[model samples]
Target: MNTTSLPKPNSMEFDIHAKLKAANSHWSYCYAVHPHDKGFDYQFNTTFVGEMEFAVYERIENYFVLVDFFKSYDEACDDAKKIIDDHPDIKKMFSVS
Candidate 1:
């Protein structure tokens, strides 16, 4: 019996891009905090689902790459600040520029 295969994702793709855009637009305002280094940054934002998340990014060249995620904003920021206060060169190690 010859069987037909399902269409590829891009062949008849749903409005996935639009959906993602809408979802991303609904997220709360983001706060960029913890001035680590020239090439390292930290930010925290709440999602549309009301979940809070913090992100750590490291810059390679012209763009930044996500390094890690944390759960609490206050906790993460406090911990990061403490680390920076204790060791100013911690974030500099991850910096590219």
Candidate 2:
């Protein structure tokens, strides 16, 4: 038998990390949260390579902003859905499936 210790993730941290991992499967990207923003800001890149990369950001309070360089809106949507599916708790947050 093998046992591995995975660090326990807080609710918000788990949601964000899970979402980002799901997004990465479809879009070659990286996601991170800004500590100073109190989880209000998230950053993601839509490309595997650096030079042609694009970032997408969402501000928890105000709006969801699309930063365009490449990639389709549909892809982003699908990625978002995958994230929700990967973590059911997120659906519970809005009381929907």
Candidate 3:
């Protein structure tokens, strides 16, 4: 009798292109209140070519005080919050539920 060992399956690799496509396909907007700035910011995830992209915009009065683009929404939000929190004059802003 001969016994054969089953080959182990390789861990799934993250497909950057596929993920970017999916993220763009399901593109939706979300935002988090800045812990120190009473300003509104917009965030969205998109795909460019075959790479993931993220964007954030903060409007102050009638001008955009902050405009940022990132590789992921999570990173964009994190950076935006840090900026808002660092300003002592700004207060965290939130939307009404």
Candidate 4:
């Protein structure tokens, strides 16, 4: 819960808001991860926001980025929790679509 000593992440390579827009633009939703630079791609797809579907591609020195795709809002939140359990420092970086 304490972030005072956490290392700052680099700028995102991919745009979170952009992905959210594309996800909300239609039924297809997306979830992915990217570092401040172009280097890799996802951590994958899951069931959709209502119906059914996803990336995790981020690496900044000693850090690893992870992303999860879901079928509902609950799924997204759940994934966020799990991620936080393992990566509490990146909690603020999470974006919802």
lDDT of 2 by residue, 1-97 (tens): 1122223334533343454444442332333434565745544444544223334555545444433222332323434544444556543543424
User: Cα lDDT of model 1 overall?
Assistant: 0.37
| lDDT (Cα, tens digit) per residue for candidate 1, span 1-97 | 1122222234543432342244353322233333454544433222323444444444445444443333333333333444434544544533466
For this target, which candidate reaches the highest TM-score against the unseen true structure? Answer: 3
Ranking by lDDT: 3, 2, 4, 1
Please report the candidate that would top lDDT against the real structure.
3
Encode model 4's per-residue lDDT on 1-97: one tens digit a residue.
Answer: 1112212124644444454444553323332334453454323323345434423323434444444333333344344446444654444444464
Model 2 clash tally, residue pairs: 0
Write down the RMSD of all candidates, one decimal each: 15.1, 13.3, 15.7, 15.6
Please give the CA lDDT of all the candidate structures. Answer: 0.37, 0.39, 0.40, 0.38
Model 3 CA deviation exceeding 4 Å by range: 1-47, 73-77, 81-97
Clashing pairs in 3: 36-90, 36-91, 36-92, 37-91, 37-92, 38-91
Pairs with backbone N, CA or C atoms under 3 Å apart (clashes), candidate 2: none
Candidate 2 accuracy as lDDT = 0.39
Clash number by candidate, in order: 0, 0, 6, 11
TM-score, every prediction:
0.29, 0.23, 0.30, 0.22
Off by over 4 Å in 1: 1-48, 73-97
Consecutive 10-residue window with the lowest summed lDDT within model 2:
1-10
